[model samples]
Target chain A: MRARFNSLPPRLKRGLTVFFVLCFAITLADLVVHKHGDHWWNFFGFHSLYGFVACVILVLVAAWMRKPLMRDEDHYD
Target chain B: MINAPFLILFAGAAISWFFPAALRKPVLLIFPVVGLLNLIALDPSQSWTVSLFDVELTLFALDRLSFIFGVLFHIAAIIGLVFAWHVEDRPQHLASLLYPGSALGVVFAGDFLTMFVFWECLALSSVFFITARGTERASRAAIRYLVIQVVSGVLLLTGALFLFHDSGSVAIRALSLDEPAGLFFLLAFGIKAAFPMLHNWLTDAYPEATASGTVFLSAFTTKVAVYALARSFAGLDMLIYIGAVMACFPIFYAVIENDLRRVLGYSMINQIGFMVCGIGIGSELAINGAVAHAFNDVIFKGLLMMSMGAVLFRTGEMRGSELGGLARSMPRTTGLCIVGAASISAFPLFSGFVSKSMVMSALLIEHHEWVWLAMLFASAGVFHHAGIKIPYFAFFAHDSGKRPREAPAHMLIAMSIAAALCIGIGCYPWLLYDNLPFAVDYRPFDIPHVVEQTQLLFFSAMAFIWLQLNGLYPPELKSTNLDSEWLYRRAWPSLYGRLCRIAGWGQARFYEAVGSLTNALAPPLRKQAFLLLMPWSVREMLMILMILLAAILFLLFLHRPL
Candidate 1:
């Protein structure tokens, strides 16, 4: 599914809005709410950022990995 | 519990082979239901022991752990049997019966000896599922699958024998690494659990299985291994790190992997990683999480495999590169697949959310901070690859223009049953929690838990959407990628063939040079060599025999009667 556009689809727009709103809400709550401990990971938005960035890197690295790993379908022959 | 359910399956399997294809369907469909009823009738706290050579072996038993698996396997069997109602392949029907039977046998086995017998039976019975595809690839893959499975069995037997020698007993119980057999048991269970490098057999073979056969294949083998580990290897610290690695590594391979079923295989390993890590934590809640995830995984992963299998059956295509726009025809299958994807992705109200969150919470309680992070990464990656990529490419992507008919009625019934369970488990996890080996004290729907999990998944999906729009997402293509099997399946074999060719050339040249040198240096020597090396005629053979006889007689005469 290849689609190159400058704008997000309406479904994606709505999803992103929910995601951003959640991130903001969690961030505000984390400042006042006493979690089990105050730590870097306990900070809100870490899960979101890590999840997003890790997945992006996962895709890029995996795509680049194909250069070294990929071979002909009949490579065994 | 074990004998009744497994006996029902085994007897039905044997009898099924004799039935004509038309008659086999009823037998295939009825026996698993009977077995389920029988399973439900049994006492959860029960054991049956027998004497063999002055030793006690438990052939049938049930604890909370094995009892749940017994029920799960029966349900999986029923769903699988119903899915294959239209399949006239009797051997697959037989394998389908015995494979789940063997899994239940393993689950209820209270001693090593009984477990080993059914462990090997699991290997032997499941191979036919792959072979039922009857393609060249399927045949070769079946052999490879059999070899790996038998290797796991051999390891199991080796560990059992060692346990017997060290302890003079073979009871299944929690073990520590100090025991002689502990590491062997870990490696054995590790292999079947699809521990990182030992995992290629799963990805290599499952995709090659027959359409409905893969559904049965997905439900039983690795989950039984998980049960074995939870019984024996729970609280082993190394599994935490091993499980973390298992969780993370498959995401890389799965992203660029073209085969849709193979992607799910990787996803299966990823999901198993969560269970393994939870088992390593070994608290009551953690163990509960591990076992619960195992239960949920069988249902959800089976659902996904059935959906893919249905697509394969309808269109004769499995690779993502070759499938798209299937929703136009198979709307029900598409919707069922989305439910599976959502469940596996751990959407808030899906089966995965209820169980998988338990593992994450357990990780925090046990202070496995790094492993917790790894699992979260795996969770996001799973959403990207399995949850989104699977349905997106299979049903919603660039049209490959293949407009095949919808899945048959039986297959839809199977998918709908699984989808309903996914929803049922998600909504009412207490039905599962009350049956756990330990008391359940965790809440999965807490505000922080649900909110954080949703953030992780939604952001992960956002990343996926961004990648797709930017043309950075790896497009599906038909190609082989190097895995651990590359060493043997390709590299070593190629090296051996080259060495053989070189040695053959060198030997031919050496022979030619020797022949020329002999002719040039001494013609008489060459003639003598020819005469000695020439093929013998019948007269020459007789003459040689006579000479040998005369020499023996002379020697005997010289020695006399001494």
Candidate 2:
């Protein structure tokens, strides 16, 4: 199974990439066509931007938290 | 009519002890199915009342809420049993049955007394699974877990006594905050619900449990607390902020924690926070959403835990740092785990999407703008940790050159059933919605909702990929993250050690001062004091009494008549 995945043809790999891009394109298109329930959500790619910003904040905060919160595995012992 | 689901499970636990090894597996599998059937046949309005010592205890009460929880627990029990079927240990099997039985007891309890009894039973029975691991860390973690659970139980009983005193009844119904006992009840439920600062026991202990034991542990305890909070404290305004904090803080810990199971434990808190917020909103839609989410959480969260269990079983490793690239060897487990991760992250067309959106929508309708924003951030954060990090590090990251075989057939079967439920409930929510305590008017699959959710999840994935490409994502390390448990586990012990040293120093100074004073006075006073130390003879006692009498007479004469 690993060999099959590792040896996948370039065309198949490109097809998989296209599939993901198409999915994102559909949601992006919905930003223009669909009437959103909330005005805040109506901005083009609002959720996509919101998701990206939220994740970046999470990573930064976790990095800060590590200074105080991280300890040896047997810190309690 | 004579049987309750709790009784069926408890009896099955007892009978399984006497069964031979070959017969034990079937006995374990059959009990939960029988219990599920018994609950299905139960009448919702019926009550089984037992009067003892002038306190009427409702041992069994089936209502819409209890009915939903009862069915969920039974299903969880069956799935947990299937996952643990390969084990030959009798005690672990007994604990698996009894643990859910106690939770079923909590759900069906109609009064505070009955609830307290089952609540304690839940604590006692569940501890065995942790201790069954037979490692020092597991044993210590179990003890801490037991202490927290027992404290919750004690608080519940104390609150019940006060509630009964004030109200002249122990009925398990919605309570007013004005009641003096209300705070105790809330704290009790808060501890079990893993409410913020009160949540460390879950992360501390769950990762230490045996692999299969963690699967069962994931299902019952915290969800029972969610059920209790919904039953009694729904619409309490304080829960709104409390639940928001609960939802938000854990993602950071999950992000940096090395243990994969502990990460899932943190994610469990994040999921329950949504349900708590839903209950706090208290609208029909919100309550329905909370109950529905609770049901979905058990299946998906249990699925996540089971996958991790399978990983640990194969690799004997729980740390993400030590595990990677197992997808080639355990592809089926990987697929199932991704299903769990997707469901937990609330991806479109998954169980989480169907249920969690109800809470978010209700928050918006109630004009809780800040809370709605926090939950949205949490949704994105959950996608980062539980959704991406779990599968990424465990399965697809840098190969650690360990190629263990796939999980056993039973574990896969259990995971498949749970995975199927996660999708089934996502695609067709009405099967769950129809059983909610309140009517659900909200729709989950509207075009805007689907589009927005997909955009959020996909973009979150993009961020993870971006961080990885930049070499900026934190690597999993072999370490612990300090949480609230630091107070008891580290701070308190260190403080006690310092206190003992100070106390010992004070005592030494006190003795030294007394010893020096005695030594200085000893030469002059020793001879005189030696006479007093001699045993009193009868003649000496008489002479001393006569002298005392004469002194009294002289004093009487000296003050005569004045």
Candidate 3:
């Protein structure tokens, strides 16, 4: 499976990038469309930005938490 | 009345004990189906109630809410039974039946007394799954799990007693927080719901259960708590913030945790938070959303647990640090796991998207802007840990060169059913929504909702990939991340040890002071103390003689005076 994935053409290798581009484009299109509910939905790409920011914060905070929270598997023992 | 679903399951559990090995699996599978059939056949117009010692108990209340939960538990039982078909353990099988039976009992209960009875049964039956692993860690974890569950049960009973005392009725109904009894009930439900600090038992125990045991453990206990909360405490405003904290905090732990199953345990709490928030809103749409989400969670989370169980069964490993690239060997499990992951991540056209959107939309409808934002953040965080982290490290990261066979046929069939349900519900949500307790007018697949959800999930995936490629993502390591359990597991024990040491020191000093006082008084009192310590017989004889002479002299003097 790894070989197959690696053997793919450059265009295919960029599949992840293409997916991200498409997501961003959808977000852009959603900006012009008026949503039925919450005024927050009217903001351009609110959910996309929220997702990215939340994930980044999660990773950074987890890394910080490791200093105090992480211990040997047998720490309790 | 003769064939209450819970009774059938209990009877099945009892009879299965006498069944031979060949008949056990069939018995296990047939019991749930028969019970489900019995449940379906029951007349909703009349409840099965009994009077015990003049106290009324409702055994089967087939209302819409209970009906939905009842069907979900029965279906979960069937899936769990299939997943464990390869096992020959009798106790585990019994527990699988009894656990679901007790959960159904809680669901169908019409009064607090009946709920309490089933609540305790659920705790007792479910603990077996954790202990069935038969490891020292599993035993310890099971004990902790049982303690927490029993505590919750006690809280429920105590609250019920108070409620009965105050109202002279035991009917399970919505409670106002002005009464102290309501507080106790809230706490009891909160503990099982994995409310923040009370949550450690779940993360501590579920991961340690037997491979299939964890699957069953994942489905019933917390969802039953959700049912209790929704039934009795809906619209309690405090649950909104509590649910927000629950949804957000676990992701940090999930990010760094090495145990894949433990991460799932944390994610379970996060998902439950959404349901809880909806219950707090207490609107028709919100309550329906909460119920639907609970239904969806059981299926999808069970699928996730089954996939992890299959991995554990094949490799005897639970840590992400110890597993990678198993897709080469267990491609089917891999594919199914990703499906579970997508459903949980709320990717468009998955079970999660259909249900979770309801809670988010409900929060907005209730004008809970801040709470809605927190849930939105949680959605992304869930995607980070459960969606990206779980599948990424377990199946696709650097190859660890472990070649395990695919999961057994029964396991695959079970997982396929769950995965199909997830997609089926996502694509055609009306099938689930039509059965909700309230009329649900919410449509999940509106263009804006889909676009927003898809953007959020896809962008989260992008972040994961970006971090992974940059070597910035925290590598899964063989370590334990401290959680609320630290207070009881580490801090409380250490504190007790310190207090013991201090008491020992004080006791020693106390003895030493007493001894010193005795020593200081010894010289002055020694001589007199020796006489005092002398045998009393001789001293009494001499004293008697002296007394007799004095008496005689006194008598003589008195006679002369006369």
Q: Write the per-residue lDDT of candidate 2 for residues B58-137, one digit (tens) a residue.
A: 99988889999999999999999999987877778889999999999999999999999999999999998899889998
Cα lDDT, model 2, residue B497: 76
Off by over 4 Å in 1: A1-3, A6-37, B1-3, B495-562
> After superposition, which runs of candidate 2 have C-alpha atoms over 4 Å from their true positions?
A1-20, A36-38, B510-562
lDDT-based ranking: 3, 2, 1
Error at B517, model 3, angstroms: 6.7
Question: Scored by Cα lDDT, where does model 1 land?
Answer: 0.87
DockQ each: 0.57, 0.45, 0.52
What is every candidate's alpha-carbon RMSD to the true fold?
Answer: 7.7, 8.5, 10.6
TM-score of chain B of each: 0.89, 0.91, 0.91
Candidate 1: lDDT of A11?
A: 88
Against the true structure, candidate 3 reaches a TM-score of 0.91
Clash list (residue pairs), candidate 2 = none
Per residue, candidate 1 scores C-alpha lDDT tens digits across B411-522 of: 9999999999999999999988988889898888877777777778878987887787788899999988889989779888788777666666766786699789877879
Worst 10 residues of 1 chain B by lDDT: B553-562
